[model samples]
Target: MQNLFYALTFERTLDRYSQADTTEVDVTAKVDPAGRTAQLLSAFFGLDEGLPRIADWAVCDGAGGKDGMPVIFSHEVGLNTLEPGDFAIKRRSGKLGEVTCLTLAPADDPGELRTVLLAGQFGSESDPPVSVEITGDIISLDQSVTFKGAQVAVTPLEDGPSLVLAEKVPQGQWELGKAATGIPFGGGSGCPEGTAQVLRVTWEGGITKPDGNAADDQERKLYRVTIRQEDGSEETIAPMHLADTGDGDNNHKLCLDRTEPVKSIAFPAGGFTDPRGDLNPPTYIGVSQRLIDKQS
Candidate 1:
């Protein structure tokens, strides 16, 4: 038998339709039992604490006869359903391994006015297997959860569009060299010591024929960056060639290859050679010194 220790808290307020109801609750419990399900259920309902532990619920191993397994217990505590004992459990497949620990935290949401975050670990003592988050927009594993190795993020574009970016550890410098005067390697004096970083950017363009169906092909674009140091010295790196991150919307990798601390970045308009051997139109995308400084 193992010991199960948990702390839970609940808070909610409702003021609408001539009704005002509010609840604030906090509970902490420690249970020693043979099964996690019983312990969780007992803690959730605040059942007899000192009673002898019981292992009534069967734990499934995702094999024969007990394939579809659910969390032993789950509770949704929203404005309409607010109580001290309400709690939630972030579940994972036991097939992965034995679950070690779990925790739930309330997250911030401007639209929903209520949100919960759940985190859990499996197998190892430290690595997190599942991360839960509730956002104003939507809840999803790719968008709201953090897993090992890689993570994906969504950034709202200035033009009212949304761009999804995946987190990647910037490894070796993809583009090495200096800043140039213009796109196509023509014009502007080159900065010999500069390096360039790469970032994957994905976007979808809706180009439809008169029939209103999306064109079969929509391509992604890549941009190379150059930075100027605070000391007025500029380092130039070769342009990076980003590849698809596979999420579909024109995903590309972003890399920064630099030699010195950056103070400013030059935003010039010129065409870049697309990986497909096509020339991309020129636009001004500036890199801020703050972004460069973040590298150090």
Candidate 2:
């Protein structure tokens, strides 16, 4: 029975497993014959791991009326994982700056925990930051993997909102697209035009019209897609007109006209606009799901 219980616990943790994982196991024993009460006992066990990686970084309003930037991690980090000297910044002019303080972007947004807002002189518009490095050990919340020397190039602030994530939607992911209506995928048969592919994209920030309203369906062309075909040919195309099935207001699905297999899909910047009417500069997202950042 003890072995079976241990096996169940291991299975439950399988999804979070990585390399050389270890965990502390606890045991509880029944105190009464009817098993109404329980007693705690110390125990042991182990298993997966993954290091924290930078997912996105952006410049925000600073504390001293300067810039307080946010660095988002791919994995959730421990609350106490921050330190002043853990990070190093490199700029286009080859100057360096040290982060003075760090905090969650804001306490209001519970979802912003993955982001660490920093205050320092990383770079300026004239001399943009080229990259960021993790010089000290950073630990993840789940597997507690240590992160160090993890460097990622900085996205130019002039390049408007970039992709936070993108992926191919699985079949039947959303019921909205099952039957084509006004902008739906279906044609006469309501079977979604017989041949269509869907690509889902999530931006770093919410997108809205110049008047700060939600964008129209046709506005998806803002981030135009260019795909390479299997036969070694490339064509630039916009997503087919479809109802917005984006997650929250920052994500959206792009329907593609289909005939041949596609090798890749990428988009240049400057097409998208923020609710505040900020224009996107340039950023590219491909089939491999390379993450991009934003400047707010």
Question: On residues 1-296, what C-alpha lDDT tens digit does candidate 1 reach at each position?
Answer: 11111112212222111112232222222211211111211111000111112111111111112111111111112333221122221223323322221111111111111212111122122322232211111111112111111111211111111122222223232223433212110111111233244442322111112233211222222233445677776665433333322211122334345434332222122222221222223333333112223322
Residue-level lDDT of model 2, residues 1-296, one tens digit each, is: 63345334432110111112132322122222222222111000000011012112212222343333445554445555456466677878788854545544321121223445455556666776677766655555443354455566665554445665455544354233343222111111111444366565545544445454444554656556666678787877766644343211344556666644443444455456642345654656655332212101
> Which ten contiguous residues of candidate 2 have the minimum total lDDT?
42-51
On TM-score, the candidate that comes out on top is 2
Cα deviation in Å at residue 86, candidate 1? Answer: 24
lDDT of each: 0.23, 0.44
Poorest 10 consecutive residues of model 1 by lDDT? Answer: 40-49
- TM-score of decoy 1: 0.24
